[model samples]
Target: MISRTLETTLNALALYAIAAVLGVAFFDQLVNGELPCPLCLLQRAGFLLLAIGPVLAVARGPRAAWYGVTILAGLAGAGFATRQILLHIAPGDAGYGAPFLGLHFYTWAFVVFVVAIAASALMLILRQPDGEATDEVQAGAASGDALGRIGILLVILMAAANVLSTTLECGFATCPDDPVTYQLLTPSGS
Candidate 1:
């Protein structure tokens, strides 16, 4: 009973995150036309990785298949968060540069990345039996697997929403032609 509840919670969180990310991407990226920075895109990829874990568990009737994927997602999120924070703090010298500290976008991405890492950590460590999360997802004795399938299906829909948002935002975040490029080659005139 405990395991099933925990797994369900974890699954809910993962799907919820996907939906949130997708929502942000749509409103900020699709509507605004603002593109993601390199780090922003990296974070999106991290979210995708995290989404894989729950999806696998739901589709395959087992969560074990996504263990490594979850860890990788956490690492990716951590890496992107670190990079964004550093970039915000440090200035780039030449064509390769960092954002001036205090960009709203950077701050938002950092927060999301942190949340993703925490969520992934919890999901990976939570207890479950055998490779399959089967017994846990089983509905009370009478209902069988219908509820389980419905839950999994809901997660899938949420995941799709996330993917759609990321795709839209990722397409716009890359700003290649800024006039004032920052890199070691060219120090800031200001």
Candidate 2:
């Protein structure tokens, strides 16, 4: 069922997003030469997972590995988003936690997290297994749910990486020591 062109499209988007994050990391670590703070590293990890999640889903099918990755990626996104909110919303605390408070990166990541979880959940719930009906949702769904799943995952991963980095490396929303940089070159260590 996933072998169709539509599935290929989703896989492409997921792969592209994953590759972009890797590219950014390469630039930061290799080309630009930067180090990742704790939070930044976490975010980069989340993006890697995000990129891998949907393709895995596509490969194994919704009820199989896809569901597992969907849940995992969603949870990771939620955790990252929640952490940023807590740090940014800390009442009197003004330190490394609130790094992205003024910047919209925190806000954007939170939104993406929620959206990704929602989309993954919706896609999983709405999608029928290979043995069942696949045409029902496509004919009924008009929101591009089928087409947008990968895109949504990509967005979530991108935000998770950047915002997570911001929360970790920056102090009071400012860059800090050993700050991580990002690039878009390739796979090998640069």
Question: How do the predictions measure up, each by TM-score?
Answer: 0.59, 0.51
lDDT of 1 by residue, 1-190 (tens): 2365456445645666665665565566555555555566566666666777766655544354465676677677767767766755655533223333434554565566566667556655665645454554451221224444555565566557655544443333443433223232334475
**Which candidate leads the pack in TM-score?**
1
Model 2 CA lDDT for position 75: 74
RMSD of each: 8.4, 9.6
What C-alpha lDDT does candidate 1 achieve relative to the native structure?
A: 0.55
In candidate 2 the C-alpha lDDT for residue 121 amounts to 66
Best lDDT goes to which candidate?
Answer: 1
lDDT by residue for model 2 (1-190), tens: 3323344355456556555645556464554445554554565566556656665544343343554675687578668756755765767755342233374343445565566567666655555555465543442232244544555555556656566445544535445434544222223375
lDDT for model 2, on a 0 to 1 scale? 0.52
